[model samples]
Target: MTSKVYANAVAALFDLRDGISLMSGGFGLCGIPENSIQEIRRQGIKNIHAISNNIGNSGRGLAWLLKQKQISAATCSYVGGNPDLEEQMLAGEVQVTLVPQGTFSERIRAAGMGIRGFYTPAGYGTLVAEGKEERVFDVPCILELPLGADFAIIKAERGDRFGNLWFKETARNFSPLMAMAARVTIVEVEQLVELGEIEPENVHVPGVFVQRIYQGVDYENAIEIPMYAEQ
Candidate 1:
């Protein structure tokens, strides 16, 4: 078969349509596919349903897209730092679903594992349980369904032409799970290596899950909340 590598993020995402469901891998600004997100901006695609740990802060990372009104709905754990996201939410311009950190992780995992839905007590008595089926095992547990997407755009520290990827430190947060949970997974890596450069054991995501891979440029790992000394 031919290689899975693409020339650029634009080519990798050529078939992407508006109103598509998407999963972007990251926690805050770490491990975000900034190049791909920029390409999304350049392409001017709108009305996206986004799933991630957070949508980034201010005018960077996913917040850049959110600021452009590209995102229609977001399902994520944290939305504190991005003022644009909060403003949109308050104005009823965007639909937002706040999931617990652990519940968010499990829902993505359940999709990848082909499970329909699982019960958890995380939000049993709160607003999360409203209208959802509940069963009493030891305590009341609400059914949390799986989440999937049409495409998953992820960033990696390094990868091979065959699509195997490896991420660094905290950057590895949601990339692997997003890779597994999407219909087409596209990865943007800092370094694109030969087929055997990355050993079998070191590979976080196998090529089978990733349909396309590309070398990204100018990665700005911006901190969402920068802490500075008092002046």
Candidate 2:
């Protein structure tokens, strides 16, 4: 096969469908594919369902897309910073499914592993348990379902042209897992190097999971951090 396109990295991210599910990797504005999210916003794609740790703070990360009314539903663990999201939820403009932090991570991991599904005790008798199959194994558990996406937008600290990726610190959380679960994974990295530059052992995501990779430029360093801290 020929090499993939490299220019205009954001072009790799536009799905444009009304009901496509998207997995975005980030945690409270950390490790987010800001460039891809901005492109999605600029593309004006509607009715996107996002699976992520948080909705991202206002004007940053996925919040940029949420601000544009591009997201229709969110399966997230936390969404405290965006009032628009809260208002939308109250008015039924958006659907929100809150997942526990641990359960959320496991869902993405399970999808990556191709294990079909697994069980967990995270939501046993709450609303999360409603309408879901229940089974008692060695321990009390609810049958957790697999989670994958039509597309996954991930940010890496560094990536090789061949698509091997490395993430920094806590930023590594969901990016690698989401990379595997999506039909098409687009990775935006702060630094892009030629193949063989990154050590094989340090690669968090293999090229097989990533269909598109690009070098993003001019990422705003001050992303949604507290005002008390200097930018």
Candidate 3:
């Protein structure tokens, strides 16, 4: 129902406050909310905790937040590529909580389902098991805690004013799951169309899960990462 359009990135993210939890939906560079990420850096929101798969490369993606010293902690699966993030973690400026990839995905699913926790054996007998209650399953196992976020930033290939979303191939990435697990989900889309343009079966994220929708500008063609050969 709120079909307004914003002129720039700053206007879109002007309401973000310091120390809030954010769930950024992307795998590396795919499906990242580039414009909103830039706005967050420009706004200088500090002490933020991000739930994401991997921090983006230097000078791009969520790495911009680390470069700007805007993050206080990160709950992520991988954090090796960004040197500033590693340095900050080592210097005690940033806290890092590493979760197994499968468990991490399940936690977000649990959050969306309104479940408190789920059972997982991924981190048993390791540092991840510490401070968690244990219960016997087939032999002996315990469930880890569910994870959720106060806010989520995701990208969609196309979205309508009513908030129905569609995604492009790999860009479908984490956008769907992250949309449901957050208190507020903001969507950045390659195209913004009028309501009823998208087919019902084509909608990946329904309007109920999204709080904001903005048309992204300057979406470049696929970025080539030099570290690995293209798939």
Could you tell me the lDDT of residue 59 within candidate 2? 55
- True-vs-predicted CA distance for residue 137, candidate 1, Å: 1.8
Q: Clash pairs of candidate 2?
A: none
Report the lDDT tens digits of candidate 3 across residue range 141-178.
66877788989988888998767899888887667888
Better-scoring candidate (lDDT), 1 or 3: 1
The better-scoring model by lDDT among 2 and 3 is 2
The most accurate candidate by TM-score is 1
Local distance difference test, per candidate?
0.89, 0.83, 0.82
Q: How would you order the candidates by TM-score, starting with the best?
A: 1, 2, 3
Residues 1-231 of candidate 1 have per-residue lDDT tens digits of 877889998889999889999999988887899999999988889999999888766667888888889999999988887788899999999899999988898898889889999999999889878989999899889999999899999999999988899899999998898899999999999999988888999998888888999999988887766799999
Could you give me the TM-score of model 3 versus the true structure? Answer: 0.90
Report the lDDT of model 2 for residue 89: 79
> What are the RMSD figures for all models against the true structure?
2.0, 2.4, 2.4
